[model samples]
Target: MNHFFRYFVVGGFSLLVLSCGTAGDKAQAETVTERVENVKVSPLKTLQIDREINVSTTLEGYETVNIAPSVTGNIEHIYVEVGARVNAGDLLVRMDQNQLTTTKLTLANLSHDFERVKALSETGTVSQQAYDQAKLAYEQTRESVDFLSANTFVKAPIRGVISAKNYEDGELYSGTPILTLTQTHQLKALVSIPESYVPFIKAGMTLEVTSDIYPDVRFPALIEMVYPTIDASTHTFQAKLKIPNGDNRLRPGMYARTSIKVGEVNAIMVPYQAVLKLTGSNERYVFVVKNDSAKRVRISLGKRVDDMVEVFSEELAIGDQLVTVGQARLVEGVKLNIVK
Candidate 1:
């Protein structure tokens, strides 16, 4: 009976030990099976990306004109000064009136003589040749008088600000420009874009320009012209942008930076943190979390704008969850616990 009792006790202890080992194995297996890494994920989205080129530039006047008298005379009256605004056909200066008065008197005498001779010719009292001579002289004198009168009042050719004024009242006009006018209602922005971007640049493309002078203002401009040829040395092409400055807020000499949208493409954009560079190869990749598993997808990178980067991959789809944070510790097919 003692031997039987001892054997029964040993079997019972062995059975208990075996049960404990089995339970421990099951727990270990469960722990391994349930292992997962917490990661922050963001859904990949489709974005319309505009490829752009940024260039520094300076603003210029839309149109510049020099105002000068067509005839030689002494300036009698000055109507504008530097920085004065004028419109087309507005009188800017007046020439001496003595020349105009003399021409008018001569023209009046010639007109009276021509009419008397014309009436005589109609009455058959004067020769046709004499009448022709009087008419020609009168026409010539009238033209000369009209020319003198028109030049007496120097007018603005364009609507703009008088940027320069050289002569004043009583100044002799020696065929020199009296004033310089620049159109400020519209401005021009000259930007040099890379030659590679020349093909994509077209007229009417929108440009966003910013200036240090107006820190809070972003001036909108349109691509007005694209030069036909590129600069051989710089490998760059020049593009002209028209900026509307009807308020005259933007000056011609102001320094500016321009952003031109050269082209556009549909791409998958993700946070900067999601893209990773491989340790050895030059390949870039991102982790896509699908069905509780991490998938490694190789991608081609395009333009980067701020914190977002454009990625192209055949395996990536819009709305797919991508591991943005905690992806460094992940491998392909690894289980994921998506967190915020």
Candidate 2:
């Protein structure tokens, strides 16, 4: 009878323990089901925004010329100084005239001999071979004289300001240029634009440029040229812009910022807070509520408007609920209790 009593007690205790364990597990399951993250969301919408391409570059001269003589000689005179403005056809420098005078005298003597040889050949007094030799000599001397005259007087090829003067008067002409002339009436800016913008850019389009030195000024510019091919390494193409600097206020090598308005674009814009950066990477993403669960979507970002930024993604669509608030506390596929 004692043995039976002990057995009954052991069986009862085992049943009680099992019953308590089952109830605890049920309570724990309920707690987990109630744990829903509270978040605020905004519906995605398309906004019309101005599409602009902005690039920074340096201003350069419209035309630059290095004035130097073709022949090596003593520089007899330098008519222009640094910062001097010159017009086309203006005499810039004069080389030594002694060589030119000697060549001209030789040419005169050759002309006389050639004329005498031609008359003798016609009269049968000289052979045809002698006449030919005389004619060749005269022609050669005349060409030499002409070349000397041109090189002796160096003239300005274009209207520009003398930016540099390398040699002084009576200096021997070496390989270096005598003067550096730059056209300052207009300026050009070469900017590298991404290949994607090539379709929108074309020759003769108008653009706007600004300089930090002239913060209040907006210089008008026109597209002069667009490179036909893109750089494979950089995935960009070059564009040339011509800016009118009639006042001569803008100088070469000045820092400039250029803006080109291709056209307007319809973009999906969301609150800036909705965008989040992936940890340890530059990739950006945003979360949206999908079937009461948080769904992470990767995005490419564009220009930022006031309190909002442009976002692009294949998974995003208009009227989708985007999480703007309480996103930091949620993870992928987490149940969300949306709040107003």
Candidate 3:
């Protein structure tokens, strides 16, 4: 009876040990099963890529004029205030007549002396040298008077709005600018494009421009000027576009974005959403399916058109399935299940 009891106890212990071992084996097998992520992918393709470049710049006045008095004097009267629209040659300010009046008085005296000296010299009453001196003095005084007279009435140089007023009536002019006039009927957008695009950009090319201030408005601008020289350090060239602000709604110093169209080319294009930027770095990458596994590929990006982008990579080839979805949860060498 003791031997049977011993055998039963040992058998029970052995069965318990075997059960634990089987359970561990089952759990281990489950843990080792390859974790496959279900993803949607599209094959890369070669298409005629619309190579367009976008540049941001500020809108400047086509013509900016600074108004100031040529001679130092007191501002007598201001005809226009800020935001007042004026035409070219419009009288904007009038300086005090103190300098102009005094010059005219001197000119009158010089003229009287000149005429008297000429008459006396002709009659042999005065020397030729004295007559010549009086004539020269009169001419010089007349020129001074003319200069002061023209400057006394400060006129607008350009037909535009009065952007600024620096002085009021009865203020002394210390050679500071009294007003700033900007031509708002037409504005210019200066953009610096990559030097490689210089050969393709022409002076008459039409480009699309948008302003932050006018969000819903997109206007066409012509490339009025393209700088001949390229900046060596920046490897960029400047292009000026004429933006017509006929309504006088656009102002200078507003931010503008310009899109220039380059000719089409055959290139590998992918969806813009497929491109992923790695954390803590500027490097861009995308996942592609290779032999049923996800392969992360580093790529150089070019101009993006709408939802698609131009991409270049030595490791990538045409018709390779790219994993656009489920990429956020994928890593290099992860197994993939292509799903519809």
Candidate 4:
């Protein structure tokens, strides 16, 4: 009876030990399976960005007039220099007036003689021929006197400054400009628009004009005029606009940029790394992934700002998963593994 009892206890102990071991093994297997299933990677997705365009242009003033000498004489005094400001009718140069003064005195004597002859003819004290000769002489002398006044001083016709000093004091001014005058109160920017944009460009249309001299600066201007004919050499039409220079900050011959706001709105874009460029049609492409799978999608491209490019594609929906990195390892219909 004692032996049978001991054998029963030992058998019970062995069974209990086997049962605990099996339970522990099952728990460990479950833990391992859970960890393996948690390890997963997915493709990164980026939002869409808008587009922009850039073109080169120059800045110019609305009007530019050259100061030309009006009469022939020696330039006696130059009152202004390059970059000096002047008002309309301001004295620009002076000439020797000796000849002019003498001509005026001679004309005064001829006028006295003509008046006396007219009085005598009216009283029948002189012949008609005598009065006619005096009248003709008086008219010629008046012309001579008028010509002398213009030869004395070269004055500014417009409110401008001396742009160039071609002569100095005591120099000859023979109806030729001793200096160049330019008015910069307003500036005109001329832009050549491509023939494709002819329909959109017209007089009074507003556009933006900028200058590098004042970085990031822009002003409002209108399409003051447009050429009716297109330039065959460049296949573009010329457009002009007026820009105000109230502070005289913008000078003629200074470089400028003109920006035309064509369009603006929201869009989807991707990093440049995600886009693939090709020849022939200038088409761009990007890669999209879903459900551990990726495919190369052909996409149209638009304006790019910085590192991002506008993805122009109907196939690419907003918030679509894309392969930003590890694109080289991806292909059409290829399997993918999320890295992060």
Candidate number achieving the greatest lDDT relative to the actual structure: 2
Which candidate do you rate higher for lDDT, 1 or 4?
1
Alpha carbon lDDT at 176, candidate 3: 78
**Model 1: per-residue lDDT, tens digit, 1-340?**
9999999999999999999999999997676457788999888887887886678988889999887767887888988888888889999888988888998898899999999999999999999899999999999989988888778877888889989988878878898788889999999977887665555889988868898888889988999898898889776898889999989999989889987776676767888888999988778999998788888999867678889987867898888998989998887766888887
lDDT of 2 at 37: 94
TM-score of 2: 0.70
Q: Which stretches of candidate 4 lie over 4 Å from their true place?
A: 1-55, 121-133, 173-176, 261-340
lDDT of each residue in 1-340, candidate 4, tens digit only: 9999999999999999999999999886665434311112223344543322344566665655666655676777888889898888887767787887888888999999999999999999999999999999999988877766665766777886567778878776655567787778877877777665566666887766777878877777777898899998776788877877777877788877776655555656577777876657566687776555666788766566788766656677766677777775555555665566
Counted clashes in each candidate structure: 0, 0, 0, 15
List model 2 lDDT by residue over 29-107, tens digit each: 6654556899999889999999788899999989999987788989999998999988889999999999899999999
For model 1, what is the alpha-carbon lDDT of residue 59? 88
lDDT of each: 0.85, 0.90, 0.87, 0.71
lDDT of 3 by residue, 1-340 (tens): 9999999999999999999999999876564346689999999998996778899999888998889778887888999999899999899989988888898999999999998899899899998889889999999999998888779988887899888889988899998799999899999988998765666889999888887778998887899999999998776899889998898777888888988987887878898989999999768899999879889999877777789888878999988999888888887877889999
